[model samples]
Target: MTEALSSLAEAFKNVGVSRAYGTPVKVVGEELIPVALVSFGFGGGGNSEAEGADAAGLESVAGGGGGGFVLPLGVYCRNGSGHVAFRPNMIALIGTLVPLVCAVGFTARGILRTLRR
Candidate 1:
């Protein structure tokens, strides 16, 4: 599980450029699970301050977006009767919702700003 999480993080870091971020996996019972919360941020900027200055002759225009995900802990069992059962644990529900909500708010703010200008 650790290796898998490490690999995932490394992959994100490689492809995400400067804003790839991930959390370590957590273990519950016999299952290795994601940390329940993971986030990603993306932005674009000039290669140098001079280029930004030359383009805008003021401040460079940059934008960033972020989003997150949640994973819940669960349990599965099978009995001799061949019945299956599942259970969910609450941990990251709010964590996941908050980031999404914030992202939406940020998006709205950006749109409003653009409209105002």
Candidate 2:
């Protein structure tokens, strides 16, 4: 199990910002670089048990699993005249920020109550 987790960690070390940036594609004299949000997780578990009267001792089991997701966040585009701009996907932005906003709101509420007390 340890070895499995170690390999998973090593594999993830290669996942960086480069993975979020797609190859630039040019269309109608405009270059567009698609961007994304990438996320992944890994887990492993092991179990050991003593064998019943027949086998005396020793049984072991191990399991590991991993999954990942990529979400399109939008693109950076440059026109023929070299004017560059970024366009974001509103749905992804909202999905990513909702939790953060809630956390901030909760912290602010706590601070306000503490100050009032």
* TM-score per candidate: 0.30, 0.68
lDDT of each: 0.50, 0.88
lDDT for model 1: 0.50
Error of 1 at 33 (Å): 11
Native-to-model Cα distance after best TM-score fit, residue 32 in candidate 2, in Å: 0.7
Query: Model 1, residue 38: what's the lDDT?
Result: 34
Candidate 2: 10-residue stretch with minimal lDDT? 49-58
lDDT per residue for candidate 1 within 1-117, as digits (tens), equals 345455556766654412222343334423222222235544334433555587677654443343554355444444445465544445455665788999999999999999999
Error of model 1, residue 29, in angstroms: 17
Cand. 2 TM to true fold: 0.68
Model 2 ranges with Cα > 4 A deviation: 1-18, 47-58
CA shift of 89, model 1, Å:
2.1
- Kindly give the stretch of ten consecutive residues in candidate 1 with the minimal lDDT sum: 29-38
